[model samples]
Structures are given as structure tokens and as C-alpha cells.
Target: MKYDDFMGEVQHRLELPDTGRAVRATRAVLQSLGERLQAGEAEDLAASLPMEVDYYLESADSGQRFDYDEFVGKVADRANVDRSDAAYYAKAVFGLVSELVSAGEIEQVRAQLPDDYEDLFALIDAEEVEE
Candidate 1:
């Protein structure tokens, strides 16, 4: 997706008031996800995202170990939202990302994450995941 399209969709999905908030939320989720994934895996996922957001993922330190609770903590801190809102926003972002990337890529991501992260994809009705 193009940068505008990606930001607009993220703003709409998260019901954020403005572009800046959407940017923060998107970065929070992608950066936290990047920290969880290994370098190559994070790169593979970032390859399909818009350049603006891809940097958030690709730039993370990578391979930082943390559970879902800590993941929520990280996102909450980065986005300046409560833990519940962090999970909600993160889920919406992941849903959108799923639409943009291939199913194999999504599967690879899911495979790397433990079952604790499954709920984060609950919003993903990825009809477009084939590509």
C-alpha cells in the first residue's frame, strides 16, 4: 500500500482523531513486533509494508525475548495508551497488515510467535492474504 493509503486506513481502523496518532499506533505495534521477531523474519515482513511504516519494523533491535504481557507493555509505552487500548490498536494494525502481505508471510509470523499472540490477529479477516 502507498503511504497515504496505509496511514488513512490505520487512522480509520483505529478511530484515531488524526494522522499523528495513527503514526504512533502503527509504529508501536510494528516496532514491538520487530523486537519480537528475528532479523530475517522482521525483514521479510517489512518488505511488504509501506516505506514509512516499514522502517519501524526493520529498525528494531530484533530477537528481544518477551511474553504477550510485556509486549502489551511495550506497545502501551510507545503509543502512550493503556494496555487494553494498545492491544486493540495493535490488533487492528495487524489485521490491516495481513491484508497487505501474503498468507505465507502471515503464517511465518504466527509460527514464530507463541500462542499468546493469537488474540492480536482476531481482527484479521484477511481475504486478500493470497498475495
Candidate 2:
């Protein structure tokens, strides 16, 4: 999707008041996800996303490893939002991403993460089942 469309979806999905919030949340989630994923997987995911969104994933340090709580904390810090809001943002942004990317890619991302991370992707899976 185009940048505008991508942000629009994020805004709608998150029920944010404006695109600015969506942008911050999206950047937060993508950057955190980039840090979690291996360099090659990050590169692959970035390649599949819009150019604007892809920038968030570029040059991520693949060596750093953290669990779900730490991931949420990092997102909150980077997004300058509260922890609760950060978790919601992660679900919204990642749900949109799961729709945009391939199933295999989603599985690849899930494999890198712990079981706690499954809750985020479950939002996507639930939506798919509803449709």
C-alpha cells in the first residue's frame, strides 16, 4: 500500500484521532519489530512494505534480543506513549502488517518471537476468521 493508505488504515484500525498518532505508533511498532527480527528477515519485511514504512526497518541491530515486555517498553519509549497505549499500537500496526505481507513472512516473524508475541498476531488471525 501507499504511505497515505497505510497510515489511513493504521488510523482507522487503531481509531486514532489523526494520522500523526498513527505515524508515531506505526514507527514505534515497526522499529521495535525490526530490532527483534534477524537482519535478513527485517530486510525481507522492509522490502515488502511501502518505502516510507520500510525506512523504519533499515539498519536495525539484529544482535540485540529482548522478550515481549521489553519489546513493549522499548516501543513505549520510542513512541513516547504509555505502556498500555504501546501494546494497543503494536496490535494495530502489526495486524495491518499481517494483512499486507505474505503468510510465510508472518510465520517467519512469529518464529523469531516468543509465545507471548502470539497475542499480537492473534488479532490478525481472529480478523481473518471473521472475514
Candidate 3:
């Protein structure tokens, strides 16, 4: 399939209830991740964040609401670790996710590996892991 076709498939998939929730969750994680980066923690993860901050605005724009802990719990399961470990990772992943999802800097880091690319999922989930 062409790139547009592939993108369309992805867009279509995003419409599912589960998939939509996941997107919102991912967005939430990314939002927090961006915040951390703004606070100078992106370097801790070895992430060379974009100079522009527009990419991370989605977290604010997205109206979807997630229980912070519950969002982290989901990412924890995806990472195959306990919530504590997940939260640790979440902080890092969410920070990057927040940046990449943004309009300005995402293309540069878009090709990053899923596991390491956005593993901050671990840390974001740490503070408020759901029951």
C-alpha cells in the first residue's frame, strides 16, 4: 500500500473504542513527558528534544480524560513490568511522547524504536498507578 493508504489505515484503526482510548492514553503520557522535558529531564533519558515546544500541545488540546494511574498501569503491562518500574519508565516515555506528538519536533524522532523510543511509560505510571 502507498504511504497515504497506510496512514489511512492507521487513522481508521484509531477510531476503535479501544484504539481511541489507547491514543488518548498515549497522548496523556506524551503530554506529561513533554512537561518533564520542558523542566530539563529529557536529557536524563538521552533524548535530544526538539527546540520547538508546539508538538506537545496535544495534551492540552485533547479533551480525553484518563485516570493518571490507570493510564500508567496500561503502559506498565505493555512494558512487561510492575507498576513501580513502569512509573519510572513512564516519566521518561511520556516526556518524549509529549514532544514527538507535538507538531514541531515529532518527525525527527518518529522513527525511534517503540520499546526504547518511548519507554517513559514506566515513569509516568509510577506516581499514580491505578488499582
Name the top TM-score candidate. Answer: 1
lDDT of 3 by residue, 1-131 (tens): 33234223333433324444434433344454433332232332223333222244322333333344654665566545577755654554444344334433443232332334344344333433653
| Candidate 2 structure quality by residue, lDDT tens digits, 2-86 | 9999999999988889999889889888988888888889988788789999888776676468888998998899889899989
| Per-candidate local distance difference test | 0.91, 0.87, 0.40
Clash list (residue pairs), candidate 1? none
Listed in order, each prediction's TM-score against the native is 0.93, 0.92, 0.29
Candidate 3 accuracy as TM-score = 0.29
Candidate order by lDDT, decreasing, is 1, 2, 3
Clashes of each: 0, 0, 25
Which candidate achieves the best lDDT against the true structure? 1
Once model 3 is optimally superposed onto the true structure by TM-score, how far is the C-alpha of residue 44 displaced, in angstroms? 24
Alpha carbon lDDT at 103, candidate 3: 30
User: Cα miss at 102, model 2 (Å)?
Assistant: 0.5
| Candidate 1 lDDT over residue span 1-131, tens digit each | 89889999999998999999999999999999999999999999999999988999999999998988899899999999999999998899989998899889999999899999888777664443643
